[model samples]
Target: MGGLSDRFWNGAAAQLVNAIIAAVNARDFDALERYATADLLFCDSRGGQISGLARVIDWLRDVIAADPSFALQVDAVTSSNGSALVTGTTVSRFFPEARRTLWRLTFSGGRVSEWRRYSADPLPVPPPLTAH
Candidate 1:
């Protein structure tokens, strides 16, 4: 029964990752809050660690407002026993040189308890304009 429950949690955690991406893309901070625990910890790519929903909401709001083209793409997810890790890439127009970010999420009670993210690779530069 424990194994079955673990599997179920793993799947749910994976889905939560997608939900988070969608919320960010939509700039829906309120909806994103639904997936977080009260004491959630967020470790950003810039080496900043912030805790709690209000802080997270403020951070996300600032981020979204600063970069109108910010977008996230989930690449993969894995989970076991009350925790999950998600890998993904984030793209933003504001800092195009450092846009590709990989994220890892940890879950507890079907809510995100911790999130750590960093760039998996150097962000790509847009090609120079070509004469048509």
Candidate 2:
């Protein structure tokens, strides 16, 4: 039931990432925390830092309020040893921009031990519309 590198463990970890994104988009914080470790550390592209699951929950709530149409797209997943890295882009309707991010997850005893987030670039400014 608790073995790293096993098919069950790997699949569960992958699903956890998916569930986290879904919960974030749906604004279901309670469900989001279920996949996070207690000491999770999240760093936003804007240089904001959120440490621990409790703080993450608060930060997410604020984000949902500010950006009602926030959505995440998982682009790739890579795993080795006991760690997995998920890369994706987040699209926000309020600001109408997109940013790429990588989420690193570490597993221990079939449970998430740590989760860290890093962004590849700042949210880009959309170009103004012009008619020919």
Task: Give the per-residue lDDT digits (tens) of candidate 2, residues 1-132.
Answer: 346546665676678778877887888877766776777766544555556778767766666666676677888776666777898877876444677778887776654666665765443332122233
Q: For every model in order, what is the number of clashing pairs?
A: 0, 0
Q: List the pairs of residues colliding in candidate 2.
A: none
Mark the regions of model 1 whose C-alpha exceeds 4 Å error after superposition: 1-6, 95-100, 120-132
Scored by Cα lDDT, where does model 2 land? 0.67
For model 1, give the 10-residue run with minimal summed lDDT. 122-131
Q: What is the lDDT of candidate 1?
A: 0.70
Spell out the clash pairs found in candidate 1: none
TM-score of candidate 1 relative to the true fold: 0.77
| Full-model lDDT for every candidate | 0.70, 0.67
Estimated TM-score for each candidate: 0.77, 0.71
- As a whole number from 0 to 100, the lDDT of residue 99 in candidate 2 is 74
After superposition, candidate 2 runs with Cα above 4 Å error: 1-9, 45-47, 94-97, 120-132
TM match of model 2 to true structure: 0.71
Over 40-129, each residue of candidate 1 has an lDDT whose tens digit, in order, gives 887655446777878777777776666677678777888776666666666777554535556777777778888777764422232122
